[model samples]
Target chain A: MLLKLLIFPGFLFLFLCALFFDWVDRRMLARFQGRVGPPWYQPVADLIKLLAKEDILPTGVNPLTAAVLPMVSLAAVLTAGLYIPFGAFSTASFEGDLIVVLFLLSIPALAYFLAGWISTGVYSVLGGSRALLQYFSYEVPFLMALAGPAILAGSWSITHIVDYQSQTIWIALMQPLGFVLAIIGLIGKLKRDPLDIPKAKSEVVAGSLTEFSGRKLALWHLTMNMQTVVGIFLLVNLFMGQSSVFGPIPAFLSFGLKSVGILLLLSTASALYARLRIDQLATLGWRVLAPLALVQILVATWIGG
Target chain B: MASPLRSLAYLLPQLWRALKEGPHTVKYPFDPVELPAGYRGRVIIRAENCRGCSMCVRDCPAFALELEREGRDAYRLIYHPERCAYCGQCELSCNFDAISLSNEFVPGKPDRKDLGVVLVNKEG
Candidate 1:
């Protein structure tokens, strides 16, 4: 049980997948911008370099909280990974695990908010506040979007959603608006381009992470990468239908291909759009995305009922 | 503000073209850089052609050139490339074509003193 949890579908697998996906995302984004991207091993090399660097703590902040926030965020994302059904394989799938996974997925954002709020820097506080504010804007739509899939499948479990889609059609096909909303929400949640207001280098100079360095910073990066993998996997299982398209093809390979397609779409969107202002994002979310998500839910409910 | 659909229509083709054409950036270090014509780089001096008139030294804005006159048309041209601006003023000021900027880029060196080069004219 320990071996299964720790190796195949757990930390090691998630870690590698996170690095690989990061590379793919970066490469695609670079290609879209007409620039050569980093080599495949750049992510791993960066993690190693960060881990090996010296850890510096600014004076006047609580050392324990500073140290613990990143770990907490990382742990939360990793735990969320276990509940997700990767290619129909899950170590801890249970009733209402969807809610649990969503809840678990949100811990990092809170931790990020605290990470900025607790720090004494001007940029950190500003970034922290932005992260918290943006959370409300995207999270509502994100939740509603995921809820569309759940309502249609009639189960709050990821495995059941995948199973339901395998029998019928992809949730994406049933309600593409929800899929679009979910993808946008995922970008906001991950703080990628167009929604990366909190960490805009020019505006905030690494934003909430301005003070972080060495091991803590490395952990934060790993947590973000891991969260990306988990988020994409969750979306794939929710909207991409079955793990196997036809007989003789393994489930994981199909899942991987679908995930790659999603990643490409994400990278394309990221490259195409400029970052929206805080006010613009809030307006778009409440006025546009949230309403559309609500409509998607109604449509899903009507279809399911 | 352009509508989202219009923006998408404009950007999608650009992104597609960029992806198909690959990166426009030159892979430096991995590939050699192609220098354009009349590219100013390191300075080279011909001591035998020098008139000891100190025109190059006087014209050098960076004060990188020092011509020590030994005799009529005999000189020691000392060039401090570390301080050179590569403005080509010295090259233009040389009446006898004693000095010119070559197209060879200067590589970085640890020691500051190694950046200087000297050309001695014994025959006057």
Candidate 2:
């Protein structure tokens, strides 16, 4: 059990996957833009470089909170990964694990906001505020969109949802709108392009992370990268269904391939769109996506009944 | 036209083409770059062909060249690459076809003073 938690399907696995996925995301995005991307070991090299650098704290800042926020964020994301089933192996899967997973996934954003707000820099404060505002904007539609899968499956367990998908049809085929909304919400949650307003470099100078350096920044980066892996895994289980698409293929291998497909799709979307303004994102999220997600849930209910 | 979905439909094919074509950037330092004809680079001077008329020195816009006459037929041309604008005025002004710009570019050196090259030294 300790090996399961610490090695396979746990912290070590999630950390390695995070680094690999970050590299893949960058490579795909670079290819889309007609450029050569970083090498496979670039993420590992970057993390090590950041770790070896000097840690600097701003004047009048709480050093403990500044240090701990990124740790807490990374811990939350890692813990969330444990609940997510990776290739039919979840370290901790239980009833209502869906809700627990969602809540855990959200802590990083909150930690990010606090990281910005706690900093003495103007850019950090502004970035934190923007992150908070964007969080509220996307979180609603995201929750509502994910809810369609749970409601349609008639169980809150992600394993149950995956089981439901294998027996019936993929939820994505059943409710394409929800699938799209969930993807969009995942983009917002991950803060990719078209939704990366919080840390838009032109206006905010690395946004909430303006003041972060050394080990703290590395942890934050790890947290974000791991969050992407966790988010893609969740989407794969929720909408892409089980490993049935690759018949006779190992469950883990299919799960990995499907996750890469989602990563490529995410990278393509990131490459294709320009960043939206905060006001524009809020308007789209509430006025457009929220209603669309509600209609998706209604459609799912109609089909399920 | 204003819709993202419509825009995406148009952008995807272009992205596909770009991916197929590969990156436009060269490896640079690792690979030799092919320069074009008539590309102005470092100035070269032929000591044997020089008439010591000082036309090249007089017409130099950047004052990057100095012609010091040692005798009636002998002259030395000192070229300062740091001040050279690569305008090719000196090359054009040379009536004896003694000075011209070579196609070979000068690579950067750690010491700026070493950039100066004495292109001509002829003794009477």
Candidate 3:
């Protein structure tokens, strides 16, 4: 169990998968924009380059806080990975692990908030506040959307949800509205296009990341990418029935293919859409997605009951 | 609200077209770049036709050219690529058809001196 948590299907596997997914996102975005993207090893190269750079801490900022937040964010995401079922294996799961995963997933964003807050820069403060606001707006719909699957599966355990899907149809088909809501909520959570206000480069100058450099910056980037992997992993396990229809090898292959498909879907959406303002993002999350998610939960509960 | 949905409908077809068209970027460096007609890149000096005239040196906006006398009637033209703006003024000012611009734009050198091009009049 320790080996599974630390190595395969856990930290190492998720880390590598996160890097690959980021590459795919960048490559697809570049192709969409009529440009050649970086090579496949670009993410690894970037990480190495960042590590080699001199760590620069801004004045009037707590050096310890700045140094520790990135690791905290990364650890939070890696710990979240432990509960996620990849293909036929889950590293560590228990009753109500979904709640644990949900809580763990938010830690990185909170770390981002704290990092921004501690930076003592105007842009960082603005970005930190925006990040906190965006979190509040999206969390409600995101949780409500998850409730659809949990209600239908009758268990909060991720493994139980997957097993339920194997015995029945995938929850995505049953809760199409919930699936759409979840995707929208995820786009906001991931800070992708049409909802990428917090780190809007033109406005906030890299948002909360303005003060970060060197190894901290690299770890922050790694954490963001890992969040993408964890998000898609959760999406697949909860909505798309994972690995039940085939043998272990095929199940693994199918899981990979599904995750890639989700990544591509996100990339395509990001390429096609423009960034939204904070007000617009809030409205979409609160007025639109939240209500839709509530309706989905109600319908899912009615059907399940 | 409906507009976002409408844009999404418009985006799907556009995304499909982009995927079908493949990547629009050229594999530069590995594959040869397709330069347009009359593309002015680096300046080239024709030493045989050059009469050591200072018109090109004077007209160079970037002051990238220098005239040196190797001996009496033996003139050598020196070009500093680092200082060159590649504005084609030197190519246009030369009356002897001595200097022209080539389409080779990729400038690479191991040393600073390597960027300097020197041409000597062999007949002198």
Give me the candidate number with maximum TM-score.
Answer: 1
Model 2 chain A: worst 10 consecutive residues (lDDT sum): A240-249
Which runs of model 1 end up more than 4 angstroms from their true locations?
Answer: A243-249, B1-4, B69-74, B121-124
Please identify which of the two predictions, 1 or 3, would achieve the higher lDDT against the true structure. 1
Instruction: Please tell me how candidate 3 rates in CAPRI terms.
Output: medium
Runs in model 2 deviating more than 4 A are A243-249, B1-5, B51-63, B66-76
Each model's TM-score, in the order given? 0.96, 0.91, 0.92
What class would a CAPRI assessor give candidate 2's docking?
Answer: medium
lDDT of 2 at B79: 95
Model 1 chain A poorest 10 in a row by lDDT: A241-250
Q: What tens-digit string does per-residue lDDT give for candidate 1 at A181-250?
A: 9999999999988899999988988878999999999999999999999999999999987835565346
Best by DockQ: 1
B-chain TM-score, candidate 3: 0.82
Mind giving the per-residue lDDT tens digits that candidate 3 earns over B33-101? 878758888778777788887899999888888888767777778888888898889888989898988
| Cα displacement (Å) at residue A297, model 3 | 1.7
Q: What is the DockQ of each candidate?
A: 0.77, 0.64, 0.52
Alpha-carbon deviation at B57 in model 1, angstroms: 0.7
